[model samples]
Target: MNASLLLSITPYFPRPISSRRQCPLTVRRNARLQSPLCLASSSAPIATRETEIELENRKFELLRAVTDIQRGLTATPDQRSSIEESLVGVETFDAGKPIELDLLDGTWRLQYTSAPDVLILFQSAATLPFFEVDQIFQKFECRDQSGQGVVRNVVRWSIPRLLEEQEGATLIVSAKFSVVSVRNIYLEFEEIAIQNINISEELQALIAPALLPRSFFSLQILQFIRSFKAQLPVRSSQRQSVGGLYYLSYLDKNMLLGRAVGGGGVFVFTRAQPFI
Candidate 1:
């Protein structure tokens, strides 16, 4: 009877299965056993590992781009405007008060205000290394309250400066400004003089020669104000403080021009703000 059953099953078995197993009965029974489960589990882990690797690679690429920009700053001294354009994802914070910056190149000018009131001018080749306590010196042109021509000053301390200098010594090729006025012209119960100064067309034409370039002038003004506000402190009392104008100017080829403008105190807002 067993021989007869084997013959019957042999006809039903596939040729390859029968050849590999050599016994039809054994082959039929083994086909009902569970498939290998480990393969499925292993495949899942492999796929997950691949995904993680891809994500890590993406992060590395982003970091490399930042490093490239920083490296460019230290490598060479480049034009400030060119440097600003190259910093694709750079971030800015406050150090003390706001200051205005005006970058001038020939007849092209860019003006902007910064919140921290500290502007760093770096070449496109300098690498921004991570560190604590970055010492920054501010250099920009400004007009005193008397409206006499533009004078340059160097700012060394403020909330914005403290924050940036504490860690992450970055080189910035930009400008800054402050909102609060520094001069105290108002006397106790004294009437202030209101004078409307107008310039004739001939004078305006003559003054144009002293003006900075027009292209970067607006940009410089805006940048300066933004940086200055980041560093400026809010005072409780509203008093008529001394106000001045700050801007940036540079020479491209042989022409002179204006870059930016800010109306406020040049560098009188922060004395007690903490550094970051």
Candidate 2:
């Protein structure tokens, strides 16, 4: 996030070629004059090919540099603050409201509902964080009032966070959609239900080691459990209606707490003075 790091990494992007062109024939003639004719002819083609390859490589390098810069900006607090300030004049929508979209089968669409100024700021803020936009699809069948089933509709929309390195070394984020049906809706909802999927071994290897330390992992699990507990609302109906009872039962069955409880025995009753 430091400015120095940005500057140090900037060289990875290749600079544009100067507009001034070199005369190939003249260079060939000059080479022939200094070297044997046969040698010059053989080296000329090789030199041209090498130059072409170098240029192509430089272009790719430039693209990667640009992408890195944008990605870095996404994680920077200053950039986020700037974007929020820019959007101050624009109307903001509730974060929880579902954004409406329309789609066609086998196609993706990107739409923006925010004001132009707000959009500009949003894009500026997100420019570095995303890589590409794509469309995902599914099929569904529905029945009309007549109770006859029909292959009803197709959906389309853009997917944010899809990265593309080949095209201009840039990242993009966009919204996407698909068909409307019970199955499709269920699948989409299922995705939302289990959005916190754990990283696979292969993916973990790609992540920075610092980000996945043992302490961090432990803290994450603790935080998850704490949030889960906090979300269990208290019901006034009955003790059985509260999720905490079930949670306590589960803890006392399979966990260390359960073992401790098992080690404790019930108290003995004394009846010596009961008659008096």
Candidate 3:
């Protein structure tokens, strides 16, 4: 990410998560962890069969609302507020609960994000000479203490040189993250360092043109990926660090729904294969 991109990031996290380990929110699980480090417990009332059923139905409604919002490009202020309220009000998980390590760990691929930058990633798909398909995603691992861990956002791409008849190259732009706060329902990530990006021959070939006039993902713009990928060893001492407070509304073994604070947007995610 560059200065411009950093500037564009809205104040998505209204409150910075505590540096200290605090009581996390809540989670739902049918199983328990036998490890000394993990447990399925909560201060929230243990759901009875009826409660579980009701929770399931509410989740269904929220999911449906999420889908409807995603389909519409025009999201009213009320609609956005409703989305956030719905998410925060969701009882899919328990509150004032012990942090469940199992809930927090794993790779989470983005199903939806309200951020325009994310939308740009999708819109720019046509610029690559190779076919470009990717989803913005992140992964984290909670440590032994319920406190903190590392997080990585991977912009994985399946870029194929279809015109050249060569195999599509797998391109990845990874951003390193530090967990600032680890609330059960929320997370704060600050980019620490960006690995050097060695532009591949295939990628170079794809974007060798002088430029595409007035385009979002022209060869010139795509080079941001290179700068961000370069100089991995140096950590960013940001005048402003890019990060967000994610408000998790729903979570289960297979799915997650979260909305960034400040009405930035809602997101849907599923467990990715090849979990980190």
Candidate 4:
């Protein structure tokens, strides 16, 4: 199972261990298990088992779908487009359960996406993100708003900084973004902006070139929004968003699969515990 955790395109996905166990047979046979006076309906156990089986089956199917795309990551554009379409079509993973907004808080690393074009100029690499990505991630925090409100951001990851000699080096370009958004099928937000950016010697060295340019990496990447280039903002004098919507199709404790509304992109992400 640990090995399967690396099933996504980034070559590393974190999967949860199966801790879902059914009640003991004897306990199920008893009319009351947890409460003396409260009795479980006869069909409860069977329904639960069926639900478990359905979830397990869906998990396996998603794993296979992810693997298929990851394998085709390096294929031709037409082929990759086909694969991406198929990947989006396999969005049966989410059980339509309510998302625990609290659990959504944390750092998440991008692994795969079906909708790359909506937010970028060039196509992403089939194997890796089309950039010298030291690391790409987004962080979410609960906004002091009502339920399902969050402040989402995409922050770190630098440009090419002479890899070999740099020992415990600093980040060059960090896109610090913070935007209030609603947490639902699509992390919908209207006003999107860079918020702020911290530059370093690497970007300084390339002072002649465009700093924090869209084409440099991916346009969608800069917004640091949740999921794909979700809710593509219309010619943003404000900032880049998305043409379609972003759907967090699948999410476990460790793995996340984000898809674009309509038929476009799906991004895979793995949960990363923030450094202490």
Which of the numbered candidates is closest to the native, going by highest lDDT?
Answer: 3
Error of 3 at 117 (Å): 2.9
The best candidate by TM-score is 3
The digit string of per-residue lDDT tens for model 3 on 131-162 reads: 55445566766646445565666664544533
lDDT of model number 1: 0.30
Candidate 4 achieves a global lDDT of 0.47
lDDT of 1 by residue, 1-276 (tens): 233443455445443533343577775666655334544664566666665565445434433433433322332334333434322112111112223222211112112212223224332112243222223322333334232222222222212322322322233223223423321111111112111122233433343433665346555543453344322322225653333343322222222222223432121111121222
Measured against the true structure, the TM-scores of the candidates, in listed sequence, are 0.22, 0.19, 0.51, 0.46
Model 1 regions lying over 4 Å from their true place: 1-33, 71-276
In candidate 4, stretches whose alpha carbon ends up further than 4 angstroms from where it belongs are 1-43, 68-72, 75-96, 117-131, 143-235, 238-244, 262-264
Q: Model 2, range 33-133, lDDT digits (tens) per residue?
A: 86787567755766666655654454333223323223222325554343333222121211223212211112211111112422343454456454332
Q: Write the residue-wise lDDT of candidate 4 on 1-276 in tens digits.
A: 222232232244465765886577855766454555333453355456666676666555545555534423434677556545544444454546555556666778655454444234113322333233234455656434235444344533333342222121222222222322332444444434332233344543454345555464443443332222322233445566433345666666776666555776666667887741
TM-score of predicted structure 3: 0.51
- Which scores greater on lDDT, model 1 or model 3? 3
- Where does candidate 2 stray beyond 4 Å? 1-35, 69-276
For model 3, what is the alpha-carbon lDDT of residue 254? 64
